[model samples]
Target chain A: MIFLSTLPGVRAVKNLRVLFMGEMQRLQRYHIIAASLVVAVIWIGVLHFTDVDDVTSIFPLLLFLDATSMSITLIGVSMFFEREEHTLKALFVSPITKGEYMISKIIGNIVSNLQTLVILYLYAWFFKEINLNIFLLVFYVIVISVFHSMIGFLLAYRSKSFTELLTGVLKYMFIFLIPVVLEQVGVITGDLLTNLMYALPTKAALLLLNSTTNGVETWEVLYGIAYLIGLSLLLSVVIRKGFEEFVAKESGI
Target chain B: MFKVENLHFTYPKNKEETIKGIDFEIREGEVFGLLGPSGVGKSTTQKILIKILQDFEGSITYKGKNLKDYGRDFYEEIGVGFEIPVHFSKLTAMENLQFFMKLYKNHEEPDELLKKLGLYEDRNKKVGEFSKGMKVRMNFVKALLNKPKMLFLDEPTAGLDPKNARIIKNLIREYRDQGGTVILTTHLMNDVEELCDRVAFMADGKIVEINSPKNLKLQHGDRKVEVEYEMGEKLESQMFSLDDLKEDEEFFRVVKNHRIITMHSKETTLDDIFIDITGGESSEES
Candidate 1:
């Protein structure tokens, strides 16, 4: 039933599995787990401060958890390892097309993000957000994780070096994470929030979470999901083309 | 199996062409060396041959068809072990092999390959902890996993220890013995000397010389042979031209009256011949 590769059985599937396995093990480190756990704790603390006491609100943080740190971290880490191992040369030599390789990477990231999503869902259970709507929640998690992974892929492709990719993501955070956090906090405090948050991906995922858990029928949730799928697809095309160009020009043997 | 004709390639921003009009052919079963010092277009040529560098001005015909027509499938028939190793550092050695093995239409057992390179014991360890030589061995294993018809090796032994390097060289030989073609690029004269059935020396993007390593050495070599022997309780030496020495009275006297110890042809090395033909002092790189 598994015919993932043109080659036959699970060759492509195996490669995908390996890519995911490697990335997951990297995130299994104490420091990485501690950092993510701390993020979860801070989200809980924020819920207490706001007194909204809605556990569903924290759903957006998973998107933030993956997009800001996990995907960005994985891509940066992969690039650094490629440089150190000099493995891109091997990839260049293989029969696998650049397009195929990039797809494998995206699929790998999505699979690995499953673990992160499960952890987030576990945290949501503590707040009475886990319910019969689990299937819808799963769909949301998959879509959002994929969307952020595409963003990270684009980010990594644009940066010339690993350090450069990291700094670029940090700069992107300046433009992205801060505004969404402020807008969410404003909404919690019943203050006027900037509509600029509408453009942020974090806001889209958060809106989806708010609607799914709280059963809100606001247009914001639909708009956010649509925005995420559209943006993720657009970014996938852009980054794939960008990566093709990068391989063509980068002269390292 | 492949023929590259009048190939010309230049990077977009560079004024100078990196590969200037070179022609070469690799028959079905032979080890062909692209010998040159660093930046002499060896890697550039490999990149072009492997279809990594396009916008080339000439034609590359594989089995009488345009390489462009084949697309990524062309890689299925060719196994390339780069001069550098490529793997996910966080993954184990077996994991790297297992991933690459799936990319090919055909396959072999990674366990057997790992054992061949003495990497089986460490197959489960993350590649991050592997030494440089171990990574090189794994790279070789990756290349062989598909059982390719043509192999491209760019200084495949640069970082390996002597024993491992010898094993790789032998594998290249065995691959050729099984009717595989090889393209090896390196400045290591010994590698070219030992493995190459034919070699082309490049400098600044043009092949200045091409021939069998033995022929190149012989053509440019000193025509004299150095003979060492003991005569009258003293070590003696004599130089003789290989052209005609069968009837030389002095040579006969030395061989007849003295005990011959060691005699070697005064042949120039492949590197010396490369320097002579390419007319450039080899720089430290490759």
Candidate 2:
């Protein structure tokens, strides 16, 4: 184990694990996990009362809503708690890099989203007729969660308060998320609008989640996968660069 | 352990430099105090030293290497105790300490530290439920948990009772005795006087004076002694130059012939020196 630490990349991984565990512990202790479970229960309520017997079609929709919107909101909530408590200052001075901090938070949010996935999937499997591939759903949920988590970081960096963060999330939902969601529910329809939805990360996220249940065009699936992954990587770079400024702001520079 | 030379820095939005060409050295295994009033750049200097605000136009070397050259690993060798409480309120004290402790390759035992700080019984209590003083003590423990070679403490005893403050000061002294370096920043001149081996007084974005506390007192103090003697119902006081004490027979005559109420050299206090050198209020919390 000591020799492994002497190799490159091992120490960061070790620190990442420590930070990830801390994140999870905070999520539980801060009642963030309980809050997430409560939201899961709400989604289960929506599933139980739906008219359809075979709820495979709506499973991805609920998961998509959870993974995308909840991912962003939950990450924002956790970060705002850290900010309010000034724990971020403590973490800043620790022997961990910003990348590790960011990735640990993203991974922690993924776990919360996955927990919701499991609860919802199990409910669908036992109580209703479902025909989706669970493994593919897990994979899609992870991707969607990661992309939105990065968006959470961006909004968090620019927000001055929890209220401000919620405002930013609302603006994002109106601009990126609500449009795609409206189109998915057949509220808006046009080739131009449909093509424009392809340009948003949220659209790619919903596409990836929807592909799990029904057969999507192969190119669309590839586009959705490539788009979200590519956008997440781009957002990661932007976040990493912006983190120094954020740290300076948080440090009261 | 650290040398800062001609350091100058301005916030991106500000027109004036916050740290204007300040120079100082923090000796290894010694407590160095950075004393100043509000907005005079003591914290800015510390932030620079700790690698928090790095966009500065000067040179700082940690252990003879450029501070810029050091990466995140630099934090492995140091710990910071913030002036404000910075712990997860919902988490237990032990949990907070353990989380931070695991980030370092080397660490002191948190249980022993909590016990020393009178916090062992409350280790499992959530930090949100802790008293303000308890939280302050917990910050000190978190700073020491990593067994860091250098400690950067900002108002470590700001919100503690005398007994708890004494515990923290003694632990700081013990840490120094055990070959740890400390950079202390506080408006509490008493803490500075008790713990600092050397102190720098800052004002207007510059280090105006830097020396040992004793030397500063001696330099800024009177070279005379005062004698207050009781003569019947009235108190008569006289001053004598300390340099000519051996040659002055009148001082001895008063000492022998009168009832002495008080007699002492007029060495100044750190609070007075802080005021004189920094041109700021004496020992007022910032």
Candidate 3:
């Protein structure tokens, strides 16, 4: 970790994380957090209407925190607010490098986004028979939320405004939100989709957490954890470097 | 305090050059004005000097050293007040000031500056609620918090009321009085004439006219006196060349006999001299 930070540009990554968290405190907003919690509670309540095993169905609510909440709601909305307010120019004049700024967003956003998952987990504790390990559940939520956030960050960075980023995310059913649907339906449970799911950082996190709680071997969970870290780190670097061409000189207002 | 020589800059996409070889020098404790119209590259010039926009083609030497030699540590030496308001609107005025103050080495009392700018009463209020004039005032306080030796002000008086403008200009003068140098950029003739010890008029990305405002006007001004007087209950006006009037008897007698209602010389304004020197209009577009 010291070696990574000592490298030419990675030192800024930590400060960027700190600043990003600060920005999230100001931008993620209290209303949105409250609203997301309400949605998750309502999602769990919907399980009471059906005769489904409520414990198994309630896990969908936790997965939704990573799958739907951070992707469309938190990271996507942050870009929208920044576009509306137009503080990006001010950021340019300061000594805070773009790399540092992005890292800050990642750290701040990833943590705050976990609030919904925490709320859902506690909500399930009081309402349903949640058989999952507490520590593994939180670690799963954090890692999975961060992965979805980066995907959202990449899209949000490309989007000019909140409306545009939102509409862009909404307009695509097959490309953007497919992963969310594929996880919920009982039909897409074939080997190809399962392999595809394993390749995804969020799915890998969710699968690893479920398997560990189900008394899976230590080696399998660590293997899933390794894959999750490798995928997210690789995508993060690629996104940061590729966006450099357009980050400073955004095309439209 | 600063020097820019033969600086050439063109934006990445544009074919036309924005800044064309501007040369100037600023000494300590003096207010140097970079007066020009919009798209004349005044801001670009400042950016290059302050190291905001790198990759320019020219030599910028500060305190006898290349600007490129210094790193982020150099930002501690100066305070830059952008022409537009640049504050974290979510925070209070003091919060914004305090955050930026930590980034610099030399710091000043934030509350004292707030009082100086008449912003102490509203120091804890959120910046988003501030009016345009109040925000500009807050912006000035942010710049001065570092006790910078060299200050860069671009359109510093924008959106400020006359009283607020006067306060800001006075603060600038006081900053100079304390041995600090300032680079003021504006199209406001009044600000240039009042605050600048020396003014440079830029055109076509190059400085076409440079001198003290008084000297520029004097050099291009008509050396004639326009006198208005009341004679036989009728007001009369006449212009006399200062050189010819000294030898003309009637001109001398008219001034010596009648009480002068108003007497003033015909002097060109800084703007007028600028148009004459640059051979075109010099309207500011900020």
Candidate 4:
């Protein structure tokens, strides 16, 4: 506790709990959490009809999509609501720091991602055959969601409208997430191309998620954990800078 | 509580400064009005004082400490009511107030404030369902929720019936009597005339005039009393210098020999003074 308090901004994190609770409440009020549940049911439907009774191979793929894409989309949608309602402008004048605001949103996004994970995992366990380490999956989902939430912040800061934010996410999906997903599904083939997949963060995410079943090597797990954690730290700094710029613009500086 | 000196700020995308070098002081416990037309930099200056915009070129000392020396804690001591709506549309009025109320160490009771503002019955209604006047009143309630030492109010009564506007004005007076400092920005000269203790008018990013509203009127008003009298089925009027009217025989003759239709001193309104000093068209809210 003392070490945590000694961190630069941690001691000044006032109203973080209230802000996080408010975020969660608004997510429910705006039907965002309901939408996540609907998406989770869709994932459950996909798993139910698959031919393979042992669902270990496909479980990680479902989580990878949820933890990465849903995380970004949820943050984007919530922020756009704030922008539309001008609630962000009100929050700007409160006692909460920018760090606290961003952390609350990230934590709120993690809750939604975790909900999807729990729903899908419960369905697979009760209705089908599955084997994986649940604790490790939870950890990987958190890390991946945090990284993508930062991406969401960047996209939201630059987007002028909700449609523009969706377009930016689509561009990101095409460039970074699609190729890695294609390689994972056996659509693209080659030793050189397969090795180059390591450059994409989504590949690292999939590797971490896939490691729960014990096929992935120890070094690959370490690399995935390190890569995602390190990239999240780097993006945090960029996201903070972007937040300052956004505040300036919104304040009519 | 704030003393700003030679303050200058430019937007990142603009080549010229929006708040050109200007100086002003907001004394504690007094309502200081920062009045101007559109594009005159008053809003930019208010944003700077609230710590929303940094990188300003000069110095601002709040309570004798540099404004930059303050951080997130600065917001704990100040509250701002923006001109536009700033609440979550989907949240109930009470919910919106409660969410912001908990963020401050010192907070007022939401129910009491809502009742005072005549919004108690609608506390459970969503803010998106509120009328414009209700939303404006809600903004006021939110600004006072923190019990802030200093308040920044932008058009506190912009959209309201006369009765509601008076209620807001009376509440402002009561808040001032309790020793709260306020920085008000509004184009409505009537509000300024009633509420402001001192006013500064900005023109082209510079403070062109600064004084009490009465003083500004005195400085810009005509120094003659216009008197109209009924004479032979017509009304005849004449202007007498206020300085000599008490002793002038002509003024006495006019008052005694004729039935005076109307007679009064010609004191200028703040609206006329605003236009005269700022050299801008009146953007006063109707």
Candidate 5:
């Protein structure tokens, strides 16, 4: 019978751990983790038949897509499901802060997404002999996952249903990922387009992933890290500030 | 204990205020019912008290400290049961309860609660598969999982069968007897009469009436007694002023000489009072 008021920080941390574990368990029970693994396996199967040179060029893009876009979509889908079931209202009354709840969701989603990325990376390493900078890949995974999770939260907050959320994700992909797609297909080139695209978080994430998998430029790596870190920090602040407002509405207050 | 003074609130999107300068105090270890019609700010007031809808205009003191001063720790001492079921549909009842139980600093054995509510056998079943009554019972179990000092129940027994509703009502009384306070908001007058120590009727964002159920009934009831008697192969009734019942010869004669079928004081019910005090226009869904 510990009094939560006596040690607020300790209580919050404990509740955060509980919430994170519960979220992860839900992910597993819903077979979301298995589905993600299947998607990774599908990617591996497709890449197994491709040319080695093509695999080198395409693998990083596929990994980046899984880390950022797929993570964002999965988070959005999970939130919409929770909203539909009214499960979040239970969380709203619990002895946990909005910050704690948001962090738990982000961390839980990141953990599951990272598992998929690891499986895909291992398969590529053993079969395709593709070696990437593990440190850079992990860094990009964390930064990109967090940034896109926040974006997912914002989208889910505005959406009223899963179909609407899917529409929002599609719109987000078209608007934000266009520059990255054009760059990947060799349709866009030069320092001007690259510098312009670096302003977008997606492009910055791709730059980091590309630098890790292909070859690296010192300045590009430095700029990509700095840009992604700054963007993630900004998104974190915005999401933390807006979380209460979003939850209040979602709770039917 | 909770004390609220001059509380005022207006939704940002609405031009008019929702809760306007309301005042009330809930004593420790008492069941306080806040009753009103729909759109009369009952839910808004509850939200403000629960710290969900902030930016209110007045002061609320819980345990002698301003509610605004409290953080997430405020929830540690209180349990809130929403009017609607709020469990994860895909998860079993036991899983949902276990997850929520871990979020609390103090946890209760949920199995006992589920058993008390007649849901023990279905604890491992997903909530989505449950009937509406079962879901309502699960919601109550979730609210009490933390062993809270105070409980805020919104329609706690709505959609429940009489037997299950009786179980919930008894549990609430047991909680109160064990020194827990409760703030209940519901339109079910029978529950209010059976459980509340005091009730406030809110309308147009103001508490128009506040008193114990017995006191309210006395204040509004007719001060007379009605007697029904079988006379000459027909049933007849008569009303006598309660103030002079002993002295009134006719009343005495009827009681002594007539074959009295039934007799009762003409007292108003809490339901009638609720309708009268709240203008009976808006539905009682709030």
Candidate 6:
């Protein structure tokens, strides 16, 4: 044990892997993965009745929703469940760091969300003959998933219960979806509004997802990638800080 | 093994300090129990020692190094069992234990612990399906999974039946006999009396009294003995000062000439001392 403690970097990586695997197992055991798949099938079923041309337009929106909005909502629900069970207190006493705990949640949510995105893409390909940049799609999915998972942590931290978290998620969606809806309908246009929209993580995610399906200008694609990455990093730091405070308060410390 | 001096803590929203300046020590291989009433900063003090609550105004040395100087490695040698069971309800008991066990370098077989706690039959069942007592037992298993050097338990057997509670208390004693230190916090006076080598009573965030159970009992008890004897067809009782019982003619007469039914020293109970020292706030029982 003394020798192992001396090798902290190795121990940290090992603990992180264990934590991540545990989170993934919890996601599966709770039927969250099956629920995500069911949601994908439902969306694809709904689109199957629409015209093929309409499918092309709706496909990016569905993928973006799964990557960002749905990921955040699912992560929030998972966090509240853990809090209700008082498992967070158990985690705090383990050898793993708080940063590892936060990252494992982010990584776990991304993996689960990515699985849903793949199913959606397969459905789109079978019916609509969709062809796109798979690498970029996956990259944006990870970035957007981490970004939204951080938001989910913040929501869960402030909420007193799962019911309160639901209300907070609704409020968050209403505010964040406005810019995305305006951009999608061409109601907000030009470099100024688009540049301003980049400030919102949801809008930035939508821009990146659109770049994968529909053609995007090189500069816009670069800007979307940089904006989401930078915002996700900032949110990660803020969420870690807030998480420590929330845990201290919730644990009655 | 641990030395805490002048410890003080104030919650951010509170107007006054919750843990007023206090000092105590936990010797190695001994069960040191912290007893106090509700909201008297017992849990807060435990949290600080466990490193869950930082930014405190004091110094705590664990194994000769300052506690603050330790990092995540500090938890590697310590195990904490909370008052309430903390487990993933959706997962099976074994799964929960396995997941936690992997976080530490040292590992103990969960099956052995579950069997000892009578939980092996239901090890494959989800924790959410377990009874409250069963969940509490699982919490004990979780705490011991790492083969911890020092164990911190809060109400370790609050909801167990006599048999189960005895099993846990015996395990605690065995742990101590094997050179492992323990910090126990509970409202169960029986546990303190049976397990603790020394106890500290806290009232209003200060150590009002600290001593061994036997020592405290002796200190608080009246120096008298109660003697009951059968005299011809009647049972009578007499009280005698214990200090001069050897020279008391009445006590000798009753013991020599009459049928002595019962003779007992009136030792003060830990419960009595606790209530008296903590201002008679009834200990909360679950």
Predicted structure with the largest lDDT when compared to the true one:
4
Q: Which stretches of candidate 1 lie over 4 Å from their true place?
A: A1-53, A61-69, A112-114, A126-137, A187-206, A213-223, A249-253, B231-234, B281-286
What's the best-to-worst order under lDDT? 4, 2, 6, 5, 1, 3
**Model 6 residue B80 lDDT?**
86
TM-score for candidate 2: 0.96
- lDDT string for model 2 (B127-202, tens) is 9999999999998988888889999998899888898899999999999999999998888888888999999899
Q: Per-residue lDDT for A160-214 in model 3, tens only?
A: 7666777766654354346735664565777777666655554555556566346
What does candidate 4's lDDT look like per residue over B1-286, in tens digits? 9999999999888999888899999999999999888888888888889888888999999999999999777887988887778889889999999999988767999999999999999999999999999999999999899999999999988888999999999998999999999999887889999999999999888998889998888888998899999999999999999998889999999999999999988989998888888888757321
Off by over 4 Å in 4: A1-14, B284-286
What are the per-residue Cα lDDT tens digits for candidate 6 across B22-92?
A: 99999999999888888788888888998888989988999999999999988889988877879999999
* Residue-wise C-alpha lDDT for candidate 5, range B158-242, written one tens digit per residue: 8998998999999999999999999998788899999999999999999999899999999999989999998879999999999
**Deviation in angstroms for A1 in model 2?**
3.0
TM agreement with the true structure for every prediction: 0.86, 0.96, 0.83, 0.95, 0.95, 0.95
Interface RMSD, per-candidate values to 1 decimal: 3.4, 1.7, 4.8, 1.8, 1.6, 1.6
Q: What is the CAPRI rating of model 3's predicted complex?
A: incorrect
Best by TM-score: 2
Q: What's the C-alpha lDDT at position A243 in model 6?
A: 83
Model 2, position A137: C-alpha lDDT score: 84
Model 6 spans > 4 angstroms off: A1-6, A186-198, B282-286
Model 1: lDDT equals 0.73
TM-score of model number 3: 0.83
Clashing pairs in 5: none
True contacts kept of 4: 0.76
* Better by lDDT, candidate 4 or 1: 4
Per-residue C-alpha lDDT of model 4 across residues A130-161, encoded as one tens digit per residue: 99999999999999999999999999888999
Question: Chain A TM-score per candidate?
Answer: 0.74, 0.96, 0.75, 0.94, 0.90, 0.90
DockQ-based CAPRI category assigned to the predicted complex of candidate 2: medium
